[model samples]
Target: MRRILAIGGGGFTTEKEPSLVDAYIHRLIDKPRPRICFVATPSGDNRAQIDKFYEAYGSLDCEVSNLPFFNGWGPNVIPYTDFKPHLLSQDAIFVGGGHLRSALAVWREWGLDVAMKEAWNRGVLLAGMSAGAMCWFETALGGPFEQGNYGVQRGLGLLPGACAAHYHNAHVSERRVNLLAEMHRGLIPSTLAIDDFAAVLFEDQQLVKTVSWASTSTAYRVRQQNGCVEEAPLTAVPLQESLIV
Candidate 1:
């Protein structure tokens, strides 16, 4: 009964979608008012980035608990048994953007990933944007480059295969697309390239739909195997009916 909302990172609050934040809040509380935990990790300590998230969700009247990562590490490694309980007590969990590799490493070190999967199994809401959304996949493109580290790094594996974030934006530079193509050339399955302001929602481990605030975003499905590469626009197919259940 887990509900997950993954956004590609844009149009968080717009005139036409005022309920974007409220929708998340309602998913957490299922009522007018509810208490929830806000797990945020901003890669850089920019006040603007921090305030933007606060303002977006704060307007919805949801109780937010800021849990910022320590030096890029999360609160999972504190050796406190109370960590799981504290997370479970909340109606939903919201993960903010940051370095995907660092976030997943910290989460795995402290069993945060395990806890989250357990919570999801128990019907807790799991939501994220950008890096947060990328971490859930089995593989992530450009993560090793972002961390300045070489070699393939494993992801949380919540979803099988690789995911490419900021698909259109990153493609502008070509480096990101090259990295993703390189990764796809390896053993990874077809990669999911998510454009900004778009998201693919999942429920019960099944993809439900793709949503966009401005309809400017797009997704690409790329597959390379045995020296043959194939790329196609993801929107041409229906996701809900095609997702493996």
Candidate 2:
């Protein structure tokens, strides 16, 4: 009963195609009005980005609330058991982009990930962009910064294997791909690289469809081990076609 929309990078507010966002919202909440919890790690420079997200969905009948983990003006808010009930009550949860490692670390320490999974199992809509999207996979590509090539940090594991975000964006360069390819060698799984403005939808624990801004995006199924690499374009394959069982 879990419905997840993992956007590559661009968010509903930034994209010209607002229909994609609208459609996902409606699907997540059957009613005309739904309560949405906006989870963000508000770094100093992300105020504009966070505000843009609110502006996009503010008009809807939904009640939107911002739950920021990193309070720039104050100390970090550790995740606590007291927040569990409030988290479960949300109809939809939208996560914002930021330092993926920091975000995951805080989420795990506070047990927000566990609480989110419980909410999803009880039928909640989970959506996000960039770093938010990366959390859905088992492993995520760290950053383009000096944090060193890639970090195989564990994710929510909602979907198995690893995912590379900002596929065609300048942040994820060819060098980053090469590093990921080398790191994934001998792993008993495949990796998916999703380009900006693209998204892959999952329902009932399977990939339902891949959507993007009309050829502006690409999806790749990459397999590698011991320096050998093989990759192919991911077609609009049905969820049933790639069952891992």
Query: 1-245, model 1: which lDDT tens digit per residue?
Result: 76776656653422244534335435435755454555554354234444554555566766555454453232222223456877776677777676777667777776888988887778777777777677777776534443233224576677777777666775455635565556554645577777766677678767766765444565667777567766666552232233323
Q: Which residue runs does candidate 1 get wrong by more than 4 Å?
A: 11-29, 42-48, 71-81, 142-151, 170-172, 225-228, 236-245
lDDT of 2 by residue, 1-245 (tens): 78887877776545654544445554557776677777775232265655665666665666666666554221222244476777688888888777788888788887888988998898888887778887888887656433344555688888877887777777547634555555465532467777776778789778877766545575677777566766666664332222323
Candidate 1 at 203: error in angstroms? Answer: 1.1
The TM-score that candidate 1 achieves is 0.75
- Measured by lDDT, the strongest candidate is 2
Any residue pairs clashing in model 2, and if so which? none
Task: Give the true-structure RMSD of model 2.
Answer: 5.7
True lDDT of residue 80, candidate 1 = 34
